[model samples]
Target: MASALDNPLLFLLVLLFPLSAMAQTNGTISLGSSLSTSDNSSWVSPSGYFAFGFKPVADKNLFLLAIWFDKVPEKTIVWSAHRGNLVLYGSKVELTSSGQLVLSNNQGQEIWTAQVTTGSATSAAVLDTGNLVLLNSNSGITWQSFDHSTDTILPSQILDMGTTLSSRETETNYSSGKFELRFQTDGNLVLYTTNLLTNYLYNAYWSSGTAGTNSQMIFNQSGYIYLRQTNGSVHNLTLGNIVSTRDCYHRATLDFDGVFRQYIYPRNWAGESWSIVWSVPSDICTAIAESIGSGACGFNSYCILDYTQRPRCYCPPNYSYLDSSNTFKGCKPDFVPQSCEPGGSGEEPRPQFQMTELPNTNWPMSDSEGYNSKNEDECRGRCLGDCLCALAIFTGVNCYTKKLPLSNGTIGTGTTKALIKVPQGNSTSQFPFQREMCFSFLEQEGI
Candidate 1:
């Protein structure tokens, strides 16, 4: 009944009440406050869908400042800072008054920082869209976690030129891994691996094959990942049936296995796991040679698709695992290397290196020489004559002579034959099919 124009005080109180409520719901972390991994301090978004805090690296004492879906069963991390540089258990991520977001280890050593120098009043907030932003006094975002992604690209995030998504070292290790999904300056979306230290060497395994002056990749709200050019043309990168549903959260990630895949999280379900919507380099074996220095299985070994559709490494006959604990370290010769010169005493005649033919086997890299019309016999003879040639790969009339440390070897359902040189011995005559079965059995038993 107090609808009179004189009720100005009541109207002002009603307007300010919503503003105060909105501020409370936004969940801002004021300057001088810090988030600690030991205390499990975090900033949760208004809807409680996303949270930003320090997550422990598996069972290790190290931690990483990360953002993840709060309600997910696994707490799937979408972005991280200082992933490569881990901090101690008591590490703190502080938003300083100077507008810098700094991560300091237990001893007060700086692990990483956003380096924002906006000397104004700033606050950090986790938005419902999953972006953790540092906002200036004018509500302008000075820095955001979406701009510096670790391995995932959430919906509405733009991956501009020069931005890259690097996979974690392993499923449990948050350190930088070997795989990279980068938006190159040449406008091509390339996937490659970097060499260790010093002068960096890149081995590109996959590319978008497009060239433009300026290009940007984005994960739109419609669940489609696309590359947009400066001229307004768009190209879809993910061609899967990802329906844009309200309860689904979509992300494109560079998986640790050197594969770029799009996954969908059904938040509405009680215990639903992330589902793969699409993947690049559908065949893992094809991308093995795209790594730096070695293949998917390292050196002196071959890769094959196991019954579970995963890549498994195996050594040919007469070779043993270099590191039995880790097969990716490749294999080593179980017998002594055959010397070209004659041996003394009753050492008998110098053992010759014999070829063990493996059908459906292929090695992509390290082709010293090849012939278009050569037969398998000629290819074998060429390798035997050349001291540097360690293996010969032949498919139809095409021959590829590989040197030692044969990389990217795979045994698929093709007609290719990989002739591996092994020490000539009575016990080495049988093919190593039993060894393959053993490896498969071990993998199945989670050994």
Candidate 2:
């Protein structure tokens, strides 16, 4: 009041106040503050339950700016800013004086940013409810993490129209995957799978089947998700009887394997395990056969229910996995390819390919020429005659001659059989032996 610059002590106090206030602590990051990645620096919530910082991805030096359960043993990440884009070590996330929050790599390249118009006095805080917000006097909240979610939705978070939750590329990779759960403009909550190479097209696999204006999806504190319409009607999105319990955290996620599931985590539990309470499309193989790019497994592989009742990928007879480390890459022929020309020494003609019977198996979509036949024998004969037919599916006089790289194959309680053509010289005994070896290798690797 009396010319503060005249006094040295008062001037010093004035200069240090803003710097002291900018110090990050108690989950708050004042303007011009930064958190380093190499140092493992983070902003922890008041209760120390959640932390926002850089997380290592699968033993690689690259890291992702993510929010995770701090107390859990698994360090389960619920949200990520740049999921598909990883930053190198020694990166830093800083809130500039201009109110812009930026994530920069070690080479000083900006990886991501929140270009908000908060005043210079803006400050960021990580709330106990797992929301990261930036606030200032000019605007209450200029930015928030909940407004741009990655894959998981927490309780009290509203998924408004045009919002989506994208699944991660894999259990180990933090990049975007093929599945997405979106709140459509028509007021329907839909789950879809996208071709990674072409993001423009999507195939819906599940939907809420409701339409109304001003619709919103919310995850309640009682471990239930519901879609509330403008007419005040609530449609339950979660399945099964789930009850609320104290000290428990619930999250709904679009899983990497193209499934939407709700899970619960008990804070006081000894093992710190998460239990799946509900899931959509209860059967993974129930996707529509005619839908484009609808299958869970890749081409040349079949989806089957494993011992644990989870969908697993398997290669057919005389075929081996293209990439042994990753089953999603699909399979390839292990034996010699059958030539179109008939080969024999005498007048007696030799069969070039042998039919291997795979009962209860069928491909999702028929990518072949359809033929009307009297029985399975005729269907097999038709496929054997056509050089382009790699396999044939026979179902009650309906024959589908599939071309190479058969996709979306599934095994269930259906009356269909897939007649796969293998090289005639290859012995059938090698099929079981190769399958057993593959299973044993996977088991030993603990996959």
Which candidate gets the maximum TM-score versus the true structure?
Answer: 2
- Looking at model 1, residue 224 earns an lDDT score of 88
State each model's CA lDDT, in order: 0.76, 0.77
1-114: candidate 1 lDDT, tens digit per residue: 776356998777766543322334548767776777677657788888998887877556877778888988889888888765667788887777677788888988887888
Q: How close is candidate 1 to the true structure, as a TM-score?
A: 0.80
Indicate the residue-level lDDT of 289 in model 2: 44
> How far off is residue 144 in model 1, in Å?
0.9
Estimate the TM-score of every prediction: 0.80, 0.85
**Which residue pairs collide, candidate 2?**
none
Model 1 has an lDDT value of 0.76
- Counted clashes in each candidate structure: 0, 0
